[model samples]
Target: MRDIYAGSTEVIVWLGESGPKDHLGEMILPMLTADEIASLYQWHGDRRDLPKLAAYVSKVVEDRRKTGSAQDSIDIFGAFYVLSALISGVEASGIQELRHLHKSGPILRGFDALMQPRWWSRAWVVQEVVVAQSVTIRYGKLSAPWKIFSQAASQYERARLEANADSTYPYLKEQSLARFSRMILEIETTRNDWNQAEPVGLLSLLRKFRSRSSSDERDKVFALLGLVRFWRINEKKIMPDYHIDAIKVSFETTKSLLASVGSLSVLAGTLRYSECCDSNPSWVIDWNYPPTTNEDTRLFNLPWYCAGGSDGLIELHKQRVLKIEASYLDEVISVGEELVETTITRMRPVIMDWTKLCAQFIDTRPSFEHAHYIGGGSVGDAFWRTICGNLEFVKMGVNTSNFATTTVKKGFRKATADGSLAFEQLRSADYSHRRTTSIIGGFWQESNQPDPEIARRNAFHHAVECACEGRRFFVTKTGYIGVGPRNMSVGDHAFIPHGSQVPFILRNADRLVACQGDQIETLSSATGSQPTYIPAGKHAKAPEQQKVCYEAHSELYFVIGDAYVHGVMNGEAVRLETQAFWKTTSICLI
Candidate 1:
């Protein structure tokens, strides 16, 4: 079977039973290996030739190794897994079931079953399906091209989005059905042909499938090696080293990436200390761990304003130290004792009181008085935008044309006639409510129809949902407003490290200790002071003491989180004129 698949021009898969199963006592079983059994558990129904299929694939890969080419097309025999069921002569009742509200449950269940195949979760599936020249999924006795299935899935996803935005479409509100369709659609779309002229970056490709699983942890990185564009250049260095441990692989991969790019920008993916395994270095990000929050902000291409330097450059030394060009910012004098988690409800109130929050900090730390220092108009605005989940609205100003501007202005005037309304009211609820109401009114007004109060409510709910999620905030001791991870503590220092777009949180590396009596007397003797009453022959060898060392220049620290430091955000952190004189030094991260 392996020899046949390796040399054949085409391959076929029968989703149905390939042969009769043997019954031993009361138990009926099919022959398969332990590895094969583990891999196929998620596959819903019996597939007797599953072992043969695995061998055929292995043989095909082996043949490619010897001849540089292998058969890339496969024709499946059964329609059970296919989107269309007519080929199997299974009654075409699923689609009809979707039309009736009562039958939608069974239809959704059938869709889910179709997508339950372990095939999607396999690591090898990425290379196989992506590199394939053609794939035909058979429905029972009927057949259709893979493109049809892909298009149908895509259409369903788009319809789902539309249904979510416009609540009028009841049929499209079937979330489970749409989700199942999307799962299949993504499999079709995410494939890379590898024959294209341009290729994606290794990091980008890895991030795309970071959520995928493998029985062996190392396979998470090894499986994607073939898809990496720089594999040829880095082959000798990063070749599949399954013999090594997962931690070593992670460190080596990160080191290679830093050396290749010559920048600390790669560290943007690093999460708060509380969020990651404490054993891993501050610079190393575990790609296997699923991302929790602000994933988009952590991307390589940060906004220009946030980056301290124009060029993303750094020096890699001995595979342990990173020397980057940066300006030094002020040390954190104080930080809030309480740490706020970035959960849903917690985030909402933070956004609602964004201005009041900043005011509380500004009263103590007056240095952050400058508006437009970091993209947003004011410090309050910057903090608000930083914590706001929807970057689209923050980056691009709200659309006012959709609202009745005159009406909104008049309403505000009437409400504030007594002049007792707080600024927070204008910025949070009132602002979003007015804009949302205007958009909904615009839709109805243009059509000259009665107001759709339900549509208005939906719009408002969507606005609130988008506004309150993602970032964690904190306040400093001197009344400075700092925005960072929820796990931040009182002593965490905020620094605008050079080359980075935003300020980073850092912690003290050394601890202070008190010594008394003989320990202190020994320290005094070591300083060339003779002990007045030294015992005979008791030459005091000064106790080995950890001395405090201070550098005239800057010190390196552990990066804990990103922040929006008030006064130091601009050129004040690192002097631009003397930037050339800035020495490159190694920061030892334990």
Candidate 2:
């Protein structure tokens, strides 16, 4: 049987539940090694990883029992063993700092200032120290609790020696002792308080700060302060000296948030960039170095929501960005190649009369006439904050290279391109002169290259466009159609019905109305009013209520049939349909 190490939450709760016995199991439990258990526990999972103490309390207690020789030491050690085991799980949680010896319980209580010098004098403190040191050694990381006790003991000993100095003046001696005593108390108190604070709460506070009003400078200040505290606690114990750089990155992020020049939305962009460092950033997909293609890498280009992580949307976006490199792009474009092959084989002639339909015209214009390839927004600047901060798809597009663009643009320019571009053009066109600029448009190896199947479709569309202009025929092709805010920032792409010439309609400030093949009126359109239509309207929608219907949860989707049916089935959709049609006249809905 393979041994499995519990996740963070499980580790802590396990320690609390199993106490010393589980600790023994974790140490001596054979199917896996200590290092393997540690690795498994460290990997991100459904819960937090267990701390050193909680994960190895049994080892600590057993070590004391084996080594300590004196009877009084043994008695005190026994008491220490019980208390340490009880708190091991909490220490393992890694989410909270567990420092206060006083509040810790009767067996492991705080040491008095006068009793600090002689370890033999205070049997309780000695027993607790022995257990704590043992746990720390086994765990390998020095936590806040370990530091507090260690520092307090050292300071108390030093203070006592000073008090005994013969040359020491009465007034000075008293003041020095008082100051030393106060310092020890303060450190101990702070350590306890630090441990009690929650990591989740700290993250929540940071997010809230990002969401707060930009105009409220004080709010930004308060947020920064909270972040500082969060990092400071980690500095003391949460992370080791080697990992301290992560805290520094977080601090720098706070500084950028403070200096950011835009609204709350803008500030969010600054904070987002800060999250990308090796430390706290939720996910990191190194596109430059592609790994063996797996489910993890395959979903890299999907939206963050579908990507598994602490937060769905954010994770998906991060993955898409990282996968924008050559290898990932190659994989996605290959999928597109499959799309071309499938669409070509399935192409059919139009049988419906064009003149029979009634056209309701809603005069609408494209939000932007041209797609500006804004590249390279400052990784952590205020300008990026103003525009694309909280914009989901823009983050998705920017992160994934999904939006059609060649150049990189940063800050307000990125924001402008992301939003309406109405705001951007108004400010300046010389994006080249800006502090951060990347080339706008040119060619990607996979996307720019023309495939025979894709070329045929493009030619078909061009032929149709030429006919619409040269002749009076307002011919509508069979595919999907959508209309609304027509922005990913505002609306979702809606599937239009087959053989429908439709007018664009804006549902509201946030939503778009989509008419699916003229069958139902519940589609969301703000994305585009193309000739495309989704095929699996029945499967896509629940039993009834097309408007308030079922949702698709698959990572990839497919564009099938003459009417563009884009849902859960992607490259597989093409294969499924192609294989089925050759065998039967009855079309099977996938």
Candidate 3:
């Protein structure tokens, strides 16, 4: 199919009647220059280390800021002006000149509307469009190059992120257009990525398009098979077989990829990434679930650490039970509030509650000068980083990205470094104000800084919010501070699989497999963690606090997705090399 499509002269994509293709000529093109449109697309995905390209893009934006061309202003503000004139009951002729300014709003809501077409999301459409020799998108009678829609979607997203600085409309920015920008740009990027003529692995394709729209559940894997260049050796192993069940296809595909690639990376795809995650094995990647991960964010593509230690043994028994060597870190002893949503109202309370939770384990003074933890960082530094999952936003397109970990956590770090002000401030009569304002005020207050830092701050805030949005703050039995999945519990554990880059949270699969027909398997490698395996049909009468409760759980655990433990993040856990403290052992996962 790919070869045939590539040989074709041209592919004319009909993007329905209301998509960006229809509005490209009259609306989007009028507002943005060719360079700006290209720049929008370039910034659509992850930040590649392209110094020359990034510099060129910076120049274009600077030029636009310096010279907002007459047409640009008219195109931007003309729609609102034209609408107001009509509301005032002006003559139609008087409004005629400014009426065309209707195109001006394309930078805002108009562009969002243009991205509304369903064609951009169709999973089956990818191979045809991407493999084609040349492509154009048409809507109704209007036709435009595919580049117009592909690139335009990213600009609206960039604008949406920048607009959050308007505190009044911060909620509005969160609610609208930003998601559409993400969707279209992802679709566009995959298409462009395939055009590079590189042979992509099947695992990459599965992760990349996991959230894409597909009418048939099986199409999620089948549709991407043509693009899997690395799977030719095992091509017969994973061919499209519609006769098979969708869940079976998904389950088999996971095994096939792991077998072919010979890596444990796919373990990261389970639990959080799987949809209908209930019935399937905790280790399998269900295609139905939208793996809504931000690849460009903190968890991935950052300064990676090998906290998983050295790879040892990886075996799949009956191609069902996932047995691998993982360094067992700590069981979650206490669970803090789960940050359920990404709203301005919820963010403050969640962070505050988390801070209080940290306070239980360590000190947070009025001046916040304390450090008693695993990694040797100050108390304040550990608290803030753990809450945000140890993430900072860099390369956020128009939003500045140079805000370093040292720079971001320094003010809070300073509070930890010096206890001189702490005692005096506590003794002062105005200690109440000093206590409250010194910590949260310094961290959370909205800054009206100069433009660039404001964008950087907004981006930073967004990174923290998004990173912790659906996760809960957790304290390990060993006094480690971190954040895990929303559904994580007190007995759930955090570990680093030998081959994985980040730590993952997992819960005992005892009750999880009780409902399913899976057999209980004890998975441990010399840790004296030989907990009694209670069959799925049986019950453990002990409560969570009791040893026989979930705490004395077996090695077989269900994944709760990736996590950020402050001490373990930078590989100190691996460095310690003490089995009793943190053991590198084999554990079973569903």
Candidate 4:
């Protein structure tokens, strides 16, 4: 392969078949040994693996040099990994996959198989394809550039998302297409030569490729080592070490990252115990499970007041515990269990269903004060705003003044006053007012007759979709409202530890004994045993007895979920004056 790159070899040909064409104008099949066939199918014969294979070829060539052989080194192979006759020439464009066809039709069946190849999920293929100088995909005699393949994959994804959005679209088998699209898009983004001024951080990269598979679990980190830039001065600690176990590798990588970044932002990749305990530490993120919800979206959209200070650091002690420099905030005095809820299997064009869900939540409120307490504002006002999807009306530049004067808000106010309005009636009134307003002064005034009412309804539906889908909505014992992952249990604590951006759901580590796998169980389980005083080198200690008391210093909590507590988002729900002072603390996670 290096010879080809060095202009020594003219070209390297790859044959799809070993036998010659038959006299009847059909190719004669070659009998292949199991080993030969298995080798051919390895890595799905992807073109992206060529560069890594070339490295091995280079090693062999160097060995020949030491032997003083007469043969010239084959520096480059200019290789092509071909898939022969995978798709018919007529249907190769993939447009037919979007159309309705017979359930067992051959065309759709073949396309499904083509899209579902394991090659798309392999960790090695990510680097191979991204680093390759050139690639050409051949399907029998028909050929397409890699660029063309990528564009097609993107189009397929857009079509799939559109189909999912429309209730009228026929049922489509989209798993294969979706997987292929994500793989190709990742290759496009991760290439070193790609002109990205600001590279994605390690946390974002890990989250993005979490679902990619690896035969050896540790390769999940090792394969991407080449792509991780040493952006931070201390990030140089992220070096590839194939010798270590997967668990140690994960811990070390996270420790190095935390040391370099100096923030708990790394916890953005953390998952629920049930989802990650088998493969990852209690504190380290498991980058194998794909995210079920848009936690990143919430992270970016959070109000500025929730931002944490920079005086935070993480210490890994004895390779089993994490000592964090954090401010001690509120403790979880009480919490409720997970709510029994229905998943949104498909997108609904109307917002009525979501409005009813919100109304049900309002009805669960213990008192009028609880409503205003959950989300900052009057109980009636918060209820109406959430129902109307007007929580960010001013920030989003929507006409809230007009919205306030609309019949929708008036009827909602009347309902609160009379205490007789049903959720269905409130929805109907909101829709009626929106439609009337759109017809009077909205885009409908033009001949195009654009339905702003539909847009408004869709916007409301989208907001609820993001807030509720794949999420668990829970109420604290004191009537505080927050949403977390669906796996959240009744006893999980909602805590806003100081120096943390958002509230985190915590579980008692002691109770996790039954579920802790052998690997995690070996780690320390005592949260109280972590050292309370700073090490001698980092800070001077007071007199022996005057040193901070272990119990009085700080408390640690397990991070279960990143929460969106309605009343606490603005920092008004929990007052700092009443709580303990913000002191650096250590959270012991197994």
TM values, all candidates: 0.54, 0.15, 0.66, 0.57
lDDT, candidate 4, 1-590, per-residue tens: 22232242222112122112101101111323344333332333345434433432254533442353223221111111111111111112223222323211222333343444566677755654554556554333323356644654544433332221222222344443444555666666565333353444555556656667898878787766555443443343355677888777777666655554455555643363463466555667665555644343333333333534323444444445555544433433323333222222343322333334444445535554344544456554444333222322111223446554532331121123212132222244332332332223111211223344433433343344444445655555555455565666677766554444566676656532122221221111122121122211223212111111122212434567666555454444234424445343456555
Write down the lDDT that model 3 would get. 0.53
**Count of clashing residue pairs in every prediction:** 14, 42, 3, 10
Taking the tens digit of each residue's C-alpha lDDT, what string does model 1 give over 454-554? 23322232222332223345655544465554455667766554555566666655522222221110111111221122221224112332233232223
Structure candidate 4, residue pairs in collision: 1-75, 1-76, 1-77, 2-75, 2-76, 3-75, 3-76, 4-76, 336-490, 337-490
What residue pairs are clashing in model 3?
A: 75-104, 275-289, 283-590
Stretches off by above 4 angstroms in model 3 are: 18-113, 154-166, 173-175, 232-237, 260-263, 269-279, 293-303, 340-346, 361-369, 388-391, 396-450, 511-554
What residue runs in model 2 are displaced by over 4 Å at the alpha carbon? 1-139, 142-418, 422-476, 479-587
- Alpha carbon lDDT at 237, candidate 1: 35
Please give the distance, in angstroms, between residue 535's alpha carbon in candidate 1 and its true position after superposition.
Answer: 75
TM-score of 4: 0.57
Q: Which lDDT tens digits does candidate 3 get at residues 222-266?
A: 888777654433222467798998878877787665544333545
Lowest-scoring 10 consecutive residues by lDDT in candidate 4? 20-29
- Candidate 2 lDDT trough over 10 residues, lowest sum: 325-334
lDDT (Cα atoms) of all candidates against the true structure? 0.41, 0.22, 0.53, 0.42
User: Of the candidates shown, which would achieve the greatest TM-score relative to the real structure?
Assistant: 3
